[model samples]
Target: MQRRTRQQLRISLLIVAIAAGLGAVFGLAIAGAGDGDGETRAYARAALRGVWTGGLIAGLLTAWEYIYVNRPAGLWVRRLTFLGNVGVRSLIYLAAIMLSIWSGATVFSIEGADPFGWNAQTVIQVGFSVLFSIGVNFAMAINGLLGQAVFLNFLTGRYHRPVVENRVLLFADLVGSTAIAERIGDLGFHGFLNDVYRDLSAPVIELGGVIHKYVGDEMIVSWPDTAAGRSRALQCGIEFHALLAAAEARYKNTHGAAPALRIGIHAGPVVIGEMGDVRQEIVFLGDAMNTASRLVDMCRTLGRPLLVSEALRDAEPSEDGPALEPMGETGVRGKTRPVAVYAPAP
Candidate 1:
């Protein structure tokens, strides 16, 4: 989890630095009226100071979310302690950062001390800073770590026109979801599935997988095929199993049932682009996505918790490579060619 936090911290720092730098440039440009270049120089110094001060605060806030709010384990752990950690962390950050900022302003005239700043202006600015920190972090928490990558592409129109990309996809479905739902009732099932999604995210993100989408009880994760191979997507599935197994006692106590996960992996080309007029979104469309889903469905029929296609599976550096057993080629719903399936060796 510390490693996960460190990975997320890099993204947080990048987002905050860009935001603060842009804010500085625009703020200075607008205020560059009187004193000519002297005022510009002042703002430049302020901008650099602001970068360190604001960036440090942002880093702390991101780590707080990882330790107490954003992570799956954090969510449940906080739940047990009545979310006391959430309240405690929130207050500590608020007091500590504001005091630090106020001190930096008074002693060092940090950020040029926000010339002509009023109490209301300071309050509003701090409010916006808080909102920006929460928004960016949660966006990454809800979306994938590559959220900025996708959004940056959308902004640059890099994906405005469709482009073919080779990606490895892993589709996972919660086995016996219907039966579990029936026993737990709709309301209870909602919470159970929420837990499942939250739990699944840690392994996927930690392993460098980006979530493509979540469809009802199914989750689709993607990565560049080359990166996927290097990251060992196969181990991710096995890791998920080990994770759930380790949490079995907790799952039973909290949800009153233990759930099984079935996952399938495949790799090929997909059309990636930004879509929609009113609100833009990144979309992936191609047989690769569908084939991954179908292979996941095959998990139930084939009686394996994990499966991979020949295209995605590979011989590792280990003496025995990956622990994969052949499931042979099978017909897929949307493709002319049958996909070769392999299950992990038990």
Candidate 2:
């Protein structure tokens, strides 16, 4: 779609430039055959010269705008294109002013004009005026192009943050998912997983959490700032458990094993930013992400449906927030000392 729009603009600009070039040539021919009044002929020659130069410059600028505005992968590419156009257009404007001066000097003899104090100064004034006109148009073009780049990027969903720092992180997965898959058909098991995800993600987003990534039946989300991150993390834990409970209730009525979910939550500072060249990705990095993933493993080992760390529980949550139950301290791999743990109340 973008390519087609660009192609159309290019063709249109080419046609317009050709038409303007033809008009400029015809106007020049008429000026050259004017009646022999020296002053009248000189002024007519200068005016015709300025018109031709202005039209040519305008045509070139229009073509450049088509390329800079139309062909690009993203906003950054468009920005560079804009800067390049400014440089190119400035050069073209300089050339046009120079041409205008030469035509003015040739049509009115410098020695004759100097006796009336209208020699170098007069030529300089004409050049300055012409250059000023071109500069004004160039400045306006630059501003318009930059503004459009900002607006287009905003509308295209390309400006969303890749990562959020100081967030509480949550990881959740269906327990014994492989066994369930073996028992129920793949399609039925996948349907069940999708249902769980749909319900689980809603409250997280509502609580100012970003859904990071989903791995099979498991998902990752983060809340910005340590306190809010943990608070939302615990909310996600409690809500997901409830979501699973409702699903299980329906499953029992259908003679299937109750689907269970294991959750882990941790709060800490994590790096959040855009990453990738060709295919960019937003990701979370730091000990917090590792800790959250490890906590998920702890939930599996302890046979707990959901787990939260001491750091997470200590963080203040919103009034009327769900309660957390102490799970005592446990030493996990990569930790030198035991870390306190808690579970969301059922």
Cα RMSD (angstroms) for every candidate in the order listed: 5.6, 17.7
Clashes of each: 0, 2
Q: How much does candidate 2 score in TM-score?
A: 0.49
lDDT of each: 0.69, 0.63
The superposed Cα distance between candidate 2 and the true structure at residue 127, in angstroms, equals 43
The number of clashing residue pairs in model 1 is 0
The prediction achieving the highest TM-score against the true structure is: 1
The most accurate candidate by lDDT is 1
Off by over 4 Å in 2: 1-164, 251-257, 316-323
TM-score of each: 0.73, 0.49
Off by over 4 Å in 1: 1-6, 12-52, 72-97, 106-158, 227-231, 274-281, 315-322
Candidate 2 per-residue lDDT over residues 220-268, each given as its tens digit:
8776656556676776677677676777777755536677778888887
Which lDDT value does model 2 have at 25? 61
